[model samples]
Target: MTNSFINQWKFFYPNKLPISHCFRQYFSQFWFRIHSLPESKRYADTPAEYELLLNRHNQIIDDCFDSNASIFIVTGHYFSQSDNNKIYDPTLRLKYEFHPEKEINLTQANPENYDDDEEDHFYRPYSINEIWKKNEHNDLLKKIADDEVRAFMISFEQNIIIAPYDGGIDFIIFNDAKRNELINKYKDWLSPRADGL
Candidate 1:
Protein backbone atom coordinates (compact mmCIF):
# COMPACT_ATOMS: atom_id res chain seq x y z
CA MET A 1 0.00 0.00 0.00
CA THR A 2 1.43 3.35 -1.03
CA ASN A 3 1.28 6.37 1.26
CA SER A 4 -0.57 8.25 -1.46
CA PHE A 5 -3.37 5.67 -1.60
CA ILE A 6 -3.62 5.44 2.16
CA ASN A 7 -3.81 9.20 2.48
CA GLN A 8 -6.41 9.43 -0.28
CA TRP A 9 -8.54 6.70 1.29
CA LYS A 10 -8.36 8.32 4.71
CA PHE A 11 -9.30 11.66 3.25
CA PHE A 12 -12.45 10.19 1.69
CA TYR A 13 -13.30 7.82 4.52
CA PRO A 14 -11.80 9.01 7.75
CA ASN A 15 -11.93 6.44 10.58
CA LYS A 16 -14.05 4.15 8.42
CA LEU A 17 -13.54 0.38 8.50
CA PRO A 18 -12.27 -1.14 5.22
CA ILE A 19 -14.40 -4.25 5.51
CA SER A 20 -16.76 -4.45 2.51
CA HIS A 21 -19.72 -6.19 4.14
CA CYS A 22 -20.05 -3.49 6.77
CA PHE A 23 -20.44 -0.68 4.22
CA ARG A 24 -24.24 -0.90 4.05
CA GLN A 25 -24.64 -0.66 7.80
CA TYR A 26 -22.09 2.13 8.22
CA PHE A 27 -23.21 4.18 5.20
CA SER A 28 -26.84 3.20 4.90
CA GLN A 29 -28.09 6.45 3.42
CA PHE A 30 -25.48 6.34 0.65
CA TRP A 31 -25.51 2.60 0.08
CA PHE A 32 -27.49 0.26 -2.12
CA ARG A 33 -27.39 -3.48 -2.94
CA ILE A 34 -27.86 -4.96 -6.42
CA HIS A 35 -28.36 -8.69 -6.82
CA SER A 36 -26.09 -10.27 -9.45
CA LEU A 37 -28.61 -12.89 -10.50
CA PRO A 38 -32.36 -13.08 -10.77
CA GLU A 39 -34.43 -13.99 -7.67
CA SER A 40 -31.39 -13.33 -5.50
CA LYS A 41 -29.63 -16.55 -6.44
CA ARG A 42 -26.37 -16.84 -4.58
CA TYR A 43 -24.33 -18.59 -7.26
CA ALA A 44 -24.39 -19.20 -10.95
CA ASP A 45 -25.77 -22.67 -11.73
CA THR A 46 -25.21 -22.66 -15.49
CA PRO A 47 -23.28 -20.91 -18.23
CA ALA A 48 -26.24 -18.65 -18.99
CA GLU A 49 -26.56 -17.64 -15.36
CA TYR A 50 -22.86 -16.86 -15.26
CA GLU A 51 -23.19 -14.72 -18.36
CA LEU A 52 -26.08 -12.81 -16.88
CA LEU A 53 -24.21 -12.29 -13.66
CA LEU A 54 -21.14 -10.98 -15.46
CA ASN A 55 -23.23 -8.72 -17.65
CA ARG A 56 -24.91 -7.18 -14.63
CA HIS A 57 -21.57 -6.65 -12.91
CA ASN A 58 -19.90 -5.13 -15.96
CA GLN A 59 -22.81 -2.90 -16.87
CA ILE A 60 -23.22 -1.52 -13.37
CA ILE A 61 -19.48 -0.97 -13.05
CA ASP A 62 -19.35 0.84 -16.38
CA ASP A 63 -22.17 3.10 -15.30
CA CYS A 64 -20.41 3.87 -12.02
CA PHE A 65 -17.13 4.71 -13.75
CA ASP A 66 -15.93 6.21 -16.96
CA SER A 67 -14.28 4.31 -19.80
CA ASN A 68 -10.82 3.14 -18.76
CA ALA A 69 -11.22 4.65 -15.32
CA SER A 70 -8.61 4.36 -12.62
CA ILE A 71 -9.74 1.95 -9.88
CA PHE A 72 -8.34 0.58 -6.67
CA ILE A 73 -8.94 -3.15 -6.35
CA VAL A 74 -8.95 -4.21 -2.72
CA THR A 75 -9.02 -7.71 -1.25
CA GLY A 76 -8.94 -8.84 2.35
CA HIS A 77 -6.82 -11.51 4.02
CA TYR A 78 -7.93 -12.72 7.44
CA PHE A 79 -5.34 -14.85 9.19
CA SER A 80 -5.44 -16.30 12.68
CA GLN A 81 -3.55 -14.60 15.46
CA SER A 82 -1.73 -17.78 16.43
CA ASP A 83 -0.64 -18.55 12.85
CA ASN A 84 -0.15 -16.04 10.07
CA ASN A 85 -0.27 -18.82 7.48
CA LYS A 86 -3.68 -20.04 8.59
CA ILE A 87 -6.29 -18.07 6.71
CA TYR A 88 -9.95 -18.07 7.72
CA ASP A 89 -10.96 -19.09 4.21
CA PRO A 90 -8.90 -21.37 2.00
CA THR A 91 -10.14 -19.86 -1.23
CA LEU A 92 -8.66 -16.51 -0.27
CA ARG A 93 -5.30 -18.23 -0.29
CA LEU A 94 -5.73 -18.71 -4.02
CA LYS A 95 -6.56 -15.04 -4.48
CA TYR A 96 -3.41 -13.81 -2.75
CA GLU A 97 -1.33 -16.30 -4.67
CA PHE A 98 -2.54 -14.72 -7.91
CA HIS A 99 -1.88 -11.16 -6.82
CA PRO A 100 1.02 -11.64 -4.38
CA GLU A 101 1.21 -7.95 -3.52
CA LYS A 102 2.20 -6.67 -0.08
CA GLU A 103 -0.78 -6.38 2.25
CA ILE A 104 -1.46 -3.77 4.91
CA ASN A 105 -2.38 -5.06 8.35
CA LEU A 106 -5.70 -3.39 8.94
CA THR A 107 -6.09 -5.01 12.36
CA GLN A 108 -3.17 -2.95 13.54
CA ALA A 109 -3.86 0.20 11.52
CA ASN A 110 -7.63 0.52 11.96
CA PRO A 111 -9.20 1.06 15.37
CA GLU A 112 -12.32 -1.08 14.82
CA ASN A 113 -12.73 -4.79 14.22
CA TYR A 114 -15.69 -6.44 12.51
CA ASP A 115 -16.89 -8.59 15.39
CA ASP A 116 -16.45 -8.56 19.15
CA ASP A 117 -16.99 -12.23 20.11
CA GLU A 118 -15.02 -14.04 17.40
CA GLU A 119 -11.45 -15.10 17.79
CA ASP A 120 -9.13 -12.27 16.89
CA HIS A 121 -7.73 -12.58 13.38
CA PHE A 122 -5.50 -10.13 11.58
CA TYR A 123 -7.34 -8.39 8.79
CA ARG A 124 -4.94 -7.35 6.06
CA PRO A 125 -5.83 -5.43 2.94
CA TYR A 126 -4.18 -6.06 -0.45
CA SER A 127 -4.74 -3.31 -2.94
CA ILE A 128 -3.77 -2.66 -6.55
CA ASN A 129 -4.26 0.29 -8.83
CA GLU A 130 -5.72 -0.63 -12.20
CA ILE A 131 -7.58 0.79 -15.15
CA TRP A 132 -11.18 -0.39 -15.37
CA LYS A 133 -11.78 -2.31 -18.59
CA LYS A 134 -15.11 -3.91 -19.48
CA ASN A 135 -15.05 -7.70 -19.11
CA GLU A 136 -11.37 -7.54 -18.19
CA HIS A 137 -12.12 -8.63 -14.63
CA ASN A 138 -14.40 -11.51 -15.53
CA ASP A 139 -12.17 -14.10 -13.93
CA LEU A 140 -12.07 -12.28 -10.60
CA LEU A 141 -15.79 -11.61 -10.77
CA LYS A 142 -16.39 -15.29 -11.47
CA LYS A 143 -14.48 -16.28 -8.36
CA ILE A 144 -16.56 -13.80 -6.34
CA ALA A 145 -19.78 -15.19 -7.81
CA ASP A 146 -18.72 -18.69 -6.81
CA ASP A 147 -17.86 -17.54 -3.32
CA GLU A 148 -14.27 -18.56 -3.89
CA VAL A 149 -12.87 -15.07 -3.40
CA ARG A 150 -13.99 -11.70 -2.05
CA ALA A 151 -13.03 -8.23 -3.27
CA PHE A 152 -14.14 -4.66 -3.90
CA MET A 153 -13.26 -1.76 -6.19
CA ILE A 154 -12.82 1.86 -5.17
CA SER A 155 -12.84 4.87 -7.46
CA PHE A 156 -11.58 7.81 -5.46
CA GLU A 157 -12.03 10.14 -8.38
CA GLN A 158 -15.71 9.22 -8.61
CA ASN A 159 -16.14 9.19 -4.84
CA ILE A 160 -17.70 5.72 -4.86
CA ILE A 161 -16.92 2.23 -3.68
CA ILE A 162 -18.18 -0.79 -5.61
CA ALA A 163 -18.01 -3.93 -3.52
CA PRO A 164 -18.95 -7.19 -5.20
CA TYR A 165 -19.57 -10.25 -3.05
CA ASP A 166 -20.91 -13.77 -3.70
CA GLY A 167 -24.52 -12.87 -4.34
CA GLY A 168 -24.71 -9.16 -4.94
CA ILE A 169 -22.82 -5.88 -5.22
CA ASP A 170 -22.93 -3.22 -2.50
CA PHE A 171 -22.30 0.30 -3.68
CA ILE A 172 -21.22 3.15 -1.41
CA ILE A 173 -21.83 6.38 -3.24
CA PHE A 174 -21.32 9.51 -1.14
CA ASN A 175 -23.40 11.68 -3.44
CA ASP A 176 -27.10 11.31 -2.64
CA ALA A 177 -28.20 12.24 -6.14
CA LYS A 178 -25.88 9.75 -7.83
CA ARG A 179 -26.84 6.97 -5.44
CA ASN A 180 -30.54 7.61 -5.98
CA GLU A 181 -30.04 7.69 -9.74
CA LEU A 182 -28.38 4.26 -9.58
CA ILE A 183 -31.13 2.89 -7.36
CA ASN A 184 -33.68 4.02 -9.89
CA LYS A 185 -31.69 2.77 -12.89
CA TYR A 186 -31.15 -0.67 -11.40
CA LYS A 187 -34.49 -0.98 -9.67
CA ASP A 188 -35.03 -4.49 -11.06
CA TRP A 189 -31.74 -5.66 -9.55
CA LEU A 190 -32.69 -4.33 -6.12
CA SER A 191 -33.78 -6.89 -3.55
CA PRO A 192 -37.51 -7.47 -3.36
CA ARG A 193 -37.53 -7.68 0.41
CA ALA A 194 -38.67 -4.64 2.35
CA ASP A 195 -35.31 -4.33 4.05
CA GLY A 196 -33.51 -3.93 0.70
CA LEU A 197 -31.18 -6.67 1.91
Candidate 2:
Protein backbone atom coordinates (compact mmCIF):
# COMPACT_ATOMS: atom_id res chain seq x y z
CA MET A 1 0.00 0.00 0.00
CA THR A 2 1.16 3.54 -0.69
CA ASN A 3 1.92 5.91 2.16
CA SER A 4 -0.90 8.21 1.08
CA PHE A 5 -3.52 5.45 1.33
CA ILE A 6 -2.21 4.32 4.68
CA ASN A 7 -2.19 7.88 5.86
CA GLN A 8 -5.78 8.28 4.69
CA TRP A 9 -6.82 5.31 6.78
CA LYS A 10 -5.03 6.75 9.79
CA PHE A 11 -6.75 10.07 9.23
CA PHE A 12 -10.19 8.47 9.30
CA TYR A 13 -9.34 6.13 12.16
CA PRO A 14 -6.74 7.88 14.22
CA ASN A 15 -5.15 5.99 17.12
CA LYS A 16 -7.13 2.87 16.18
CA LEU A 17 -5.83 -0.57 15.29
CA PRO A 18 -6.34 -1.78 11.72
CA ILE A 19 -7.90 -5.00 12.94
CA SER A 20 -11.54 -5.65 11.97
CA HIS A 21 -12.96 -6.72 15.34
CA CYS A 22 -11.58 -3.60 16.98
CA PHE A 23 -13.40 -1.32 14.53
CA ARG A 24 -16.84 -1.91 16.02
CA GLN A 25 -15.78 -0.68 19.45
CA TYR A 26 -13.87 2.38 18.28
CA PHE A 27 -16.36 3.38 15.55
CA SER A 28 -19.48 2.31 17.36
CA GLN A 29 -21.62 5.13 15.98
CA PHE A 30 -20.84 4.05 12.46
CA TRP A 31 -20.98 0.30 13.19
CA PHE A 32 -23.63 -2.30 12.55
CA ARG A 33 -23.72 -6.08 13.05
CA ILE A 34 -25.75 -8.60 11.06
CA HIS A 35 -26.08 -12.31 11.67
CA SER A 36 -25.46 -14.71 8.81
CA LEU A 37 -28.16 -17.15 9.72
CA PRO A 38 -31.72 -16.80 10.93
CA GLU A 39 -32.72 -16.77 14.64
CA SER A 40 -29.23 -15.72 15.76
CA LYS A 41 -27.63 -19.07 14.79
CA ARG A 42 -23.83 -18.94 14.80
CA TYR A 43 -22.97 -21.47 12.11
CA ALA A 44 -24.53 -23.18 9.16
CA ASP A 45 -25.84 -26.66 9.97
CA THR A 46 -26.38 -27.80 6.38
CA PRO A 47 -25.49 -26.98 2.79
CA ALA A 48 -28.65 -24.90 2.48
CA GLU A 49 -27.70 -22.97 5.54
CA TYR A 50 -24.30 -22.28 4.07
CA GLU A 51 -26.03 -20.86 1.02
CA LEU A 52 -28.00 -18.53 3.24
CA LEU A 53 -24.87 -17.36 5.00
CA LEU A 54 -23.02 -16.50 1.83
CA ASN A 55 -26.04 -14.83 0.32
CA ARG A 56 -26.42 -12.61 3.35
CA HIS A 57 -22.78 -11.56 3.11
CA ASN A 58 -22.94 -10.82 -0.61
CA GLN A 59 -26.13 -8.83 -0.29
CA ILE A 60 -24.65 -6.41 2.17
CA ILE A 61 -21.41 -6.18 0.28
CA ASP A 62 -23.37 -5.26 -2.80
CA ASP A 63 -25.17 -2.57 -0.87
CA CYS A 64 -21.92 -1.10 0.37
CA PHE A 65 -20.19 -1.10 -3.02
CA ASP A 66 -20.95 -0.66 -6.66
CA SER A 67 -20.53 -3.12 -9.51
CA ASN A 68 -16.89 -3.72 -10.36
CA ALA A 69 -15.93 -1.53 -7.42
CA SER A 70 -12.30 -1.64 -6.37
CA ILE A 71 -11.94 -2.90 -2.80
CA PHE A 72 -9.04 -3.71 -0.54
CA ILE A 73 -9.22 -7.18 0.99
CA VAL A 74 -7.33 -7.26 4.28
CA THR A 75 -6.18 -10.43 6.05
CA GLY A 76 -3.93 -10.75 9.07
CA HIS A 77 -1.44 -13.34 10.27
CA TYR A 78 0.02 -13.46 13.79
CA PHE A 79 3.66 -14.05 14.60
CA SER A 80 4.89 -15.16 18.02
CA GLN A 81 7.91 -13.64 19.77
CA SER A 82 10.22 -16.17 18.17
CA ASP A 83 9.16 -15.17 14.65
CA ASN A 84 8.82 -11.44 15.18
CA ASN A 85 11.78 -10.52 13.00
CA LYS A 86 10.42 -12.10 9.85
CA ILE A 87 8.50 -9.84 7.45
CA TYR A 88 6.96 -12.00 4.73
CA ASP A 89 6.76 -15.74 4.18
CA PRO A 90 5.57 -17.54 1.02
CA THR A 91 3.80 -20.15 3.11
CA LEU A 92 1.53 -17.49 4.59
CA ARG A 93 -0.08 -16.96 1.18
CA LEU A 94 -0.97 -20.65 1.08
CA LYS A 95 -3.02 -20.24 4.27
CA TYR A 96 -4.96 -17.17 3.10
CA GLU A 97 -5.08 -18.05 -0.63
CA PHE A 98 -5.53 -14.37 -1.42
CA HIS A 99 -1.95 -13.59 -2.46
CA PRO A 100 -1.82 -10.20 -0.82
CA GLU A 101 1.28 -8.29 -1.97
CA LYS A 102 1.29 -5.40 0.51
CA GLU A 103 1.75 -5.72 4.25
CA ILE A 104 1.64 -3.55 7.41
CA ASN A 105 2.74 -4.66 10.84
CA LEU A 106 0.44 -3.96 13.80
CA THR A 107 2.03 -4.86 17.09
CA GLN A 108 0.33 -5.11 20.44
CA ALA A 109 0.79 -1.84 22.30
CA ASN A 110 0.79 -3.54 25.68
CA PRO A 111 1.35 -7.26 25.67
CA GLU A 112 -0.84 -9.06 28.15
CA ASN A 113 0.80 -11.25 30.75
CA TYR A 114 -0.44 -14.79 30.39
CA ASP A 115 0.07 -17.22 33.23
CA ASP A 116 -0.15 -20.18 30.85
CA ASP A 117 3.30 -19.45 29.39
CA GLU A 118 1.99 -18.08 26.15
CA GLU A 119 4.33 -15.76 24.28
CA ASP A 120 3.37 -12.34 23.05
CA HIS A 121 2.62 -12.07 19.35
CA PHE A 122 2.12 -9.28 16.85
CA TYR A 123 -0.30 -9.08 13.92
CA ARG A 124 0.85 -8.39 10.37
CA PRO A 125 -1.97 -7.55 7.99
CA TYR A 126 -1.68 -8.11 4.28
CA SER A 127 -3.94 -6.42 1.78
CA ILE A 128 -4.77 -6.67 -1.93
CA ASN A 129 -7.16 -4.88 -4.22
CA GLU A 130 -9.96 -6.77 -5.98
CA ILE A 131 -13.03 -5.91 -8.00
CA TRP A 132 -16.36 -6.55 -6.32
CA LYS A 133 -18.65 -8.84 -8.31
CA LYS A 134 -21.87 -10.48 -7.18
CA ASN A 135 -21.43 -14.04 -5.91
CA GLU A 136 -17.83 -13.97 -7.09
CA HIS A 137 -16.38 -14.12 -3.57
CA ASN A 138 -18.49 -17.00 -2.30
CA ASP A 139 -15.47 -19.21 -1.84
CA LEU A 140 -13.71 -16.71 0.41
CA LEU A 141 -16.94 -15.89 2.19
CA LYS A 142 -17.59 -19.59 2.79
CA LYS A 143 -14.17 -19.93 4.39
CA ILE A 144 -15.01 -17.01 6.66
CA ALA A 145 -18.37 -18.61 7.64
CA ASP A 146 -16.55 -21.84 8.55
CA ASP A 147 -14.03 -19.99 10.74
CA GLU A 148 -11.23 -20.99 8.40
CA VAL A 149 -10.19 -17.38 7.79
CA ARG A 150 -10.59 -13.84 9.09
CA ALA A 151 -10.80 -11.05 6.56
CA PHE A 152 -12.45 -7.76 5.74
CA MET A 153 -13.24 -5.78 2.60
CA ILE A 154 -12.91 -2.02 2.35
CA SER A 155 -14.40 0.26 -0.33
CA PHE A 156 -12.42 3.46 -0.39
CA GLU A 157 -14.94 5.08 -2.66
CA GLN A 158 -17.78 4.47 -0.22
CA ASN A 159 -15.68 4.80 2.91
CA ILE A 160 -17.17 1.63 4.39
CA ILE A 161 -15.78 -1.57 5.86
CA ILE A 162 -17.17 -5.09 5.80
CA ALA A 163 -15.67 -7.70 8.10
CA PRO A 164 -16.93 -11.27 8.11
CA TYR A 165 -16.38 -13.62 11.03
CA ASP A 166 -17.72 -17.13 11.62
CA GLY A 167 -21.18 -16.17 12.83
CA GLY A 168 -21.91 -12.82 11.23
CA ILE A 169 -20.56 -9.75 9.44
CA ASP A 170 -19.71 -6.39 11.05
CA PHE A 171 -20.01 -3.14 9.17
CA ILE A 172 -18.36 0.22 9.74
CA ILE A 173 -20.27 2.57 7.53
CA PHE A 174 -19.60 6.14 6.45
CA ASN A 175 -22.05 7.87 8.75
CA ASP A 176 -25.17 7.55 10.89
CA ALA A 177 -27.60 8.14 8.03
CA LYS A 178 -26.12 5.36 5.95
CA ARG A 179 -25.78 3.13 9.00
CA ASN A 180 -29.40 3.69 9.90
CA GLU A 181 -30.43 2.82 6.36
CA LEU A 182 -28.61 -0.51 6.61
CA ILE A 183 -30.06 -1.21 10.04
CA ASN A 184 -33.56 -0.63 8.71
CA LYS A 185 -32.90 -2.65 5.59
CA TYR A 186 -31.65 -5.69 7.51
CA LYS A 187 -33.43 -5.29 10.79
CA ASP A 188 -34.32 -8.96 10.95
CA TRP A 189 -30.67 -10.01 10.87
CA LEU A 190 -29.72 -7.76 13.79
CA SER A 191 -29.20 -8.93 17.35
CA PRO A 192 -31.87 -8.58 20.04
CA ARG A 193 -29.52 -7.23 22.68
CA ALA A 194 -29.53 -3.55 23.58
CA ASP A 195 -25.77 -3.34 23.04
CA GLY A 196 -26.17 -4.19 19.31
CA LEU A 197 -23.49 -6.82 19.93
Give per-residue CA lDDT, model 2, range 42-93, as digits (tens). 9898999988898888888898786799887777776676875444532253
Which candidate achieves the best TM-score against the true structure? 1
Q: After superposition, how far is residue 86 of candidate 2 from its true place, in Å?
A: 11
Work out candidate 1's RMSD over C-alphas.
3.5
Which parts of model 2 have CA positions greater than 4 angstroms off? 1-7, 83-108, 111-120
- The TM-scores of all predictions, comma-separated, are 0.84, 0.82
C-alpha lDDT of candidate 2 relative to the true structure: 0.76
Q: Residue-wise lDDT of candidate 1 within 48-165, one digit each (tens)?
A: 9999999999999999986799987877677765667644454354433434343545555553754453445566666767889999888888888888778888999998899999
